[model samples]
Target: MADVPALVLDFGGPVLLTPFEMAVREPEGVVRDLFLEQGPLATRQRPDPLWADLQEGRLSEREYWARKAQAWHEAGGSAPDVPVMFESLYSPPGPRMIRPQARALLADALAAGRRTAILTNDMRAFHTQDWIDGTEIIHTVDVMVDGSVEGVLKPDPELYRRLAQRLGVDFADMVFVDDQPHNIVGAEALGIPSVWLDVTDPDASFDRARTLMGLDEVVRDG
Candidate 1:
């Protein structure tokens, strides 16, 4: 098939380092210690039954974070809820929030004549308006479909269809990249090619996307 003419990216995992990765940077405190001791970071080293529960879909994303926030609050951490927890976790955001490959992929795709867009479920919900307005990827892309703003969430075919319409491309002409498997399945169900970003190895994930879009030569030559 011809190279997909447009690229759609999920904002959180694929573009930004996950909250698990950011937890290490959090100031030394009960919340940071708690996350490192019992959360996904710990799960990376050993089996965390709670992480397993999340992976098994027994806990929704909100519930998982809410549980953490509640635990942290009970432990004397400042954050008492999901939004507050995220704010504390992602403080002083700037270019550091973006993965380097995400910047290159977005720039290279646009340079190579592909429309680029971000389809995010939480940019607005989890981040402050000032942060959103100043984020590099928010301004770099040709289009941005924010689910929180639209009252829609991903893995919902309607959001995908809306992004395709906004990008002026058919589903088959776009390549969607996200770290979530369910989102990949949803895009693929509508004939949109997709890259499942491995949050553990984002470079490899971006390499897969660059290869799928045949962007290596274009970026190399330019």
Candidate 2:
């Protein structure tokens, strides 16, 4: 077993690709952001109660989005294809969504003798046991604490604590990497060091992560 100096990373945006993320960083992303974040009908990250539960893997995707579609309609937006759009956007087992930048950072971490794992809030796309272990970029890091499987998600101190316990490491011994600011805050709140991956430039993010974790292997220029 590798030394239990753990490096916990997020899957979406940071490691794996998702459509919602693509939309966020797209060339014309601001218009999409307005529709998704700033519009009158947008949830603005304030997910409805059911959607919030969905993030924690407590509710089925269908149940949560079905309710969300209703709310969108009531608010004068016609987003009836919420479920299809979500699934179709993030269809896994494809080449288009693979992100090697985060994978390379993980490989470097392992080479530096640190145990690494993936912690994600996902439902369908990332859970394929056969496919994930066989992929070149993905197979290097295997200890995954996925929300769909663990019934918890990031920004939840319980999940972070649970991961530390499962890895047999102290809270201070773990360094977390994610693309979300609030998730970073959550991890840091539990005394776990965290690295925030810049969605626009993951390479720089990993470099920043290395500095925060005091990792000195394979430094890259920003």
The prediction achieving the highest TM-score against the true structure is 1
Evaluate residue 83 in candidate 1 and report its C-alpha lDDT on the 0 to 100 scale: 71
By lDDT, the best candidate is 1
| TM-scores for every predicted model | 0.88, 0.64
Q: What is the Å distance of residue 65 in model 1 from its true position? A: 2.1
lDDT tens readout by residue for model 1, 1-222: 234568789998888777666666777776466665354345655555776687677875657767877887888767677777767766667877788898889888988878889999878877888777777678988899988899988889999988988888888888889977778888999998899987667889889889877898787787
Per-residue lDDT for 186 in model 1? 86
lDDT over C-alpha atoms for residue 57 of model 2: 55
Segments in model 1 whose C-alpha atoms lie over 4 Å from true places: 1-3, 37-46
Clashes of each: 0, 0
